[model samples]
Target: MVGSENEARITAAEFRGGAGTAAWRVTATGPQAVFRAVSLTQAASLVGPAVEAAERLGILADIDVRPEGVIVCVPDRDFGGISAAAIAFSASVSTAAASLGLEPDPARIQSVGIYVAQHSATDARPFFAAALGYEDLGDGDAVDPLRRGPQLAFNPITGDVPRRGRTHFDVSVPADQAEARVAAALAAGGRLADDSHAPAWWSLASPDNHGVDIAAWSDDVGD
Candidate 1:
């Protein structure tokens, strides 16, 4: 088994540089891949290979199989980021998908997280963590131990009142897809809230004023 100390410091660049990682995108949480499957049965077929690969590497992976496709992720809390073993597991899964004629869709891979506006993150962390059944990661962030839910991050409120809703969603996608995603959201009736961070992230509001931030800064792993 790969020790946590050895796997914890691996970076996005390192993972991308490894063989057969074109299908995966490295987010802040870890490396994720989306495989295109036509049905739930087809998606489930990939789970065995994914789990076997992780087992071979003595690592844990989250596999979510849906009717449309399957999402796989490797998140390590010990290192608080991507791990070296993740690269091997991802490569093995990619090989298995290829053998089964399933193609990986990088554009379809994304991570969703929630942001809460708090007057004092320290004071509010415990309540939210308990409510969500999450483990406080101690940096204004809380995560689902099961890796089945979106992560939550606490952002400081600048004024006595929140300018918008107390909570917003942040979707992180591959850097190349951020522009098109932003455009699509706007076309869908969402209004641009902030773009000063364009190419990195963009803040948008739904017709109902719910906020969403399209981010790509963390997924900029280069070849």
Candidate 2:
């Protein structure tokens, strides 16, 4: 995780219509193996940056644009380093900043956090590690999925709650390890939420009350 001194935090992207948190907001209810990027421009403009970032990360697979947001899908393969999630997050952040006429600091993105209405800060760690194969960095303060990008962090609500945002995790795993991953998730701090992995994915709900999706990439969505 990037230190506080080196980090600049920005939660979800807000739009011109005052549609707050619409930038990186997940639009659905179940565990989904995709990154959500909503905008007024049919999700294409929103995903433009992600395409660039994914290529830079060398995990370029393909993307799907829904009316509400764009789904940055990763193929069921490796690209030397990490892949989708971070690229999607960073790309969305950058796009949002650009839309708002502000500059996004890539070097300062410490971690992407989950907004929990109520929960212990430490509760999210084990589930993320066991479910999504994220490494517990700083015990519970941050988790490193390593495959995608950025660290996953916890964000407990303080005062007024705006919108109940969904915690998104587009986890990538091997076909053989799929069941074990599901087992670990349940045993640690997560419970099975959905079987979106269908032909190849598993979705789990964490103790911190967030959804985690463990999946291999697919190219059939926008093809």
Steric clashes per prediction: 0, 3
TM-score of each: 0.89, 0.28
Model 1 is weakest, by summed lDDT over 10 consecutive residues, at 1-10
Compared with the true structure, all predictions reach lDDT values of 0.81, 0.43
TM-score of 2: 0.28
Per-residue C-alpha lDDT of model 1 across residues 1-223, encoded as one tens digit per residue:
4545545556788888889898988865678888898989888999899989988887778888898899888875654556677888889999998887778998887889999887642356688789889998766789898877898888887664534438899998887778889999999999999999887899999999999999984544542
List ranges where model 1 is wrong by over 4 Å: 1-3, 6-8, 162-165, 218-223
Query: Which candidate achieves the best lDDT against the true structure?
Result: 1
Error of 2 at 58 (Å): 13
Worst 10 residues of 2 by lDDT: 23-32
After aligning candidate 1 to the native by TM-score, how far in Å is the CA of 71 from where it should be?
1.0
Q: Can you write out model 2's per-residue Cα lDDT over 29-100, one digit (the tens) per residue?
A: 111123333454645664556666665554434455554444443332211122224334445444554674
